[model samples]
Target: MVELPKRHKLEQSNRTREDEKLREFDEDIPDLRSLVIPWASMVIVAVIAAGIVLYNNHCDGEHSEDQLFFQSSDTMVEGSSYKESILERFLSAVTVEQHHVHKPVYEENHPSLFPLTTADRLGFSFVIIGLMVAAGGGIGGGGILVPIYILVMGFSPKHAIPLSNITVFGGAIANMILNVEKRHPLADRPLIDWDLILVMEPLTIAGALLGAFLNKLLPEVLLTIMLVILLSFTAYTSLKKAVKMYKAESRALREQGLKPDGTKESELTHINHQVEATDTNKAGDELLKDMDLQEGESPGTGDMESLAADKADELQKILDEERVTPMYNVSLLVGLFVFIISINMAKGGGAFPSPIGIKCGTYSFWMANGIMLGTIFLFCVYVRAYLVERFKAKERCGYKYVNGDIQWNSRATIVYPCICCLAGFFAGMFGVGGGIVKGPLMLAMEVHPAVASASSACMILFTSFTATTSFFVFGLLDPQYAPVCFGIGFIATYFGQIGLSILMKRSQRNSYIAFSIGGGVALSAVLMTIQSVLSLAEGEQHKSGGICGKDS
Candidate 1:
């Protein structure tokens, strides 16, 4: 604080001024510069990313049609074009020849055999019939209606297949919407039999290719013979099942001590009376209750109670064993063989292996068919494992439920995927939707017919979608013909839906409705077989016109 000389004061004043300038410079600086550079870099990167996304979207919008075309052509390969062209020419030639021969008669007088003129009316009639069946409570009214449309409207199998495929697609989409609205979860998780699917895919595809090749090369007579044999076998199976069911019911009634005058009511009444008159309490029921209580109980029950409990346990164990044992194995070798043969038949002669002049290596329809079957099998195996684990978890938890509300054990669910895979493979292999297989498989799974139908509807929708995509990609979808097939099928599908709904509703009132539906189905199948055979014979006759006896 002491006063200094003039020279020292001047130097101190200069130092103070320099220090003030330095403090000012430090005050202007900010630590945020480090953060700002990184943040700005990040923002720039985000902007670039967004721009890329926008560009892609714009490009996609500009060339969507081209993309679809490219996707379609991916599976067309080398030889499909030539084969399709030849087939088209053949069909066109046949159509022209037939039309020329029939034109004069039609011009002179309206013939009842002309199925196309009333195709629309026939379709409407099918809708009405389907509605009537639904109101009356029958099974498969939709299935019935469409086949009627096919036969009555004079649609060929090729046309019918595409039409049916579209119908299934639309109907399934509608159902999916309805189900979603009802809060049913769409299955995102895959369920299937991987092992079988893996093995069968290659085999099935090989078969399809082999069959398609054979169809092309084989004589019409041989193809027709094979088809007839296959159809005969199918019919035999159906008839056998019907007969077997009838016999089983008869035998069951006899065992129940019922008279020859067959009445379920009488049999039920006798059984009820017998059960009611016997011990009011079942030994198993008491034993189960005891088992639940015994975990916290003393070492053992007294002698008499223990003896009684043991007896009950033994009886309960026996019944439990019976309940667990499977009565049949439809996923085994025999079933697999039947499924393969059925698939071959369904695909028709056109799908058989035929070597066109254009290609050297075998062109296989089975590549796709086999993949589908194999995928289904893989799905079944996966589902089986999933169900097994779920059952184990439930058992571990000892989850309880009211009677009839008991969760299906792993065993039941496991069986379904297997059954579904086999049936679907057969159906798809034959190029059919496999509704017959789906219906029976669903029923076998202990699902109610109504529920089965609904599920089948869902399954068919997926199958149609997959098949259509594959066919389209492979260039099997002829644009010129697609509209015709789709238009007729779409109308028919709507009609079928109406009819199916009516039949399902009516089924609750009549026990025999399913049987009646079955009869109709069988009849339609027979008619279809006859038609196919006749067509094949006609083709053969044309091929050997000079050698064979010709019409005068």
Candidate 2:
């Protein structure tokens, strides 16, 4: 046979060399410095907790958890002195100074802010730990925070939900501020997926506003059941998706005659990008046809050898890196309306009045424009998002990423905002941050668990901040707890974020861990549902006679 062309041989050799390099490489693992931060953080928090509890216990005389210098009053009824009629409540809702600075006084006849004692010490520790776990994994800590306040501190749901959200705002704020810092090693691509956050934020805030309003509309039992179902589905779907992806990936790699690693399938996908409907190498095919009858003893071997000698697949392996997958616009529009209703409801039944709802009837005077501004901003996000993306007007974050096993889908676009809207609605309606399960849902959609969790952490901040603002607007989040709970919670949450950054950065495969966290959250939701049921049952028992009581 005549010599093969030098150009073809050079190209063939290059393909072989490149493929060998790709097959041999591995990503580097994170080093010791990453471990130091989380360990030190744990020590500092533990020491402070131990010292504070010891000091408070040693100085103050033993007191019951219920021991308070001031007690909450019921049925104030907006007495004859002030005309807080339903109409007046509506007008004054935005005008009320619910966030006034809280004064702490234990002197004669003076009201106290949050009382700090042994019980508070216990509460502070538990709250910090729970939030740390949740925030580290990109949850808002609402899953555990609600139960902490209700069960440990004896707060009613009305009180606990708002307080928990307001408390988590501390952590979210801390993490947001930290996100701005460029000194961190991973600053180039920070954990906060701002691209996803931008799309999800407004919808989530709007939902929180509406849900806060919806808080009083439902019976307590219904809310409990809904949350339990939502959480359970989140956990189940995440585990199921992870397993399915792993198996599919394994099978594909097996067929490809490659040992499975996380990177192999993505490499094959990169190769797939070069495949086209029409054959690309007509000249090469024609040249081979002329040589087809030549050397191989077997007639079949001649054509097979010529086909194997053609190196077109190797040459076309470069992927089309950025592929567009559009999100459904109709779902987003529907979500927008839902968010507005939730927000209005959060304004002390501004949209729909309920007996248990706060009525903000005061005419707009100071800060009344907040709702209007927020509404315009949220609606604008929905309307402008498509235009911005379509025109390539400015460089913004992409809504979806196509990573190894993870990719974008229109369904994700529809499902994601719907979840946010629901979470927001309930957050506003019940004063509880509902995005705690958002991480799991994102994971189920095949996002890298770490990225999903990070996105969750950032998004929860918006949900919590918005919900807390409503609580402040409606006089639900007492300013007294601001310093102790919100302030302290903020510091604790910052540390949690730090710990999370260190932990997530070190892991190469975090899907299993992420799924486990989701499972734990689902279990927590189950407990919350049981608690809601017992609370209703106990109330019924009170209406009837107690077990031991004789008719008086």
Compare the candidates by lDDT and give the number of the best one: 2
Model 2, 435-462: lDDT tens digits are 5545654554445565566566666665
Tell me each candidate's TM-score. 0.44, 0.51
Model 1 residue runs over 4 Å out of place are 1-116, 123-157, 174-291, 295-379, 398-421, 470-507, 510-520, 540-552
Give each model's whole-structure lDDT: 0.38, 0.48
lDDT of 1 by residue, 1-552 (tens): 121333244345435544543453344223222222332343344335434433443345432321122132243324445323443322221111111111111011223433546665665466444433322122223344445445665555544454445544554555444332221111111112122222323333333342333233224554344434433443344344435545665676578665434545645555645553332233345334433423343443354356445555555443343233122321442344445444544432232222221111213333434544674455446645654564444332222221111133444444334334344333432333455434433333333333334445444444456555444433444454345544443444455545544542332112232333344345435544565566665662232111111122
lDDT of 1 at 309: 55
Cα-based RMSD of candidate 2: 17.9
After superposition, the stretches of candidate 2 with alpha carbons farther than 4 Å from their true spots are 1-118, 180-190, 206-215, 239-347, 350-401, 404-419, 422-431, 473-475, 505-507, 512-520, 540-552
Among the numbered candidates, top TM-score falls to 2
The CA lDDT at 431 in model 2 is 43
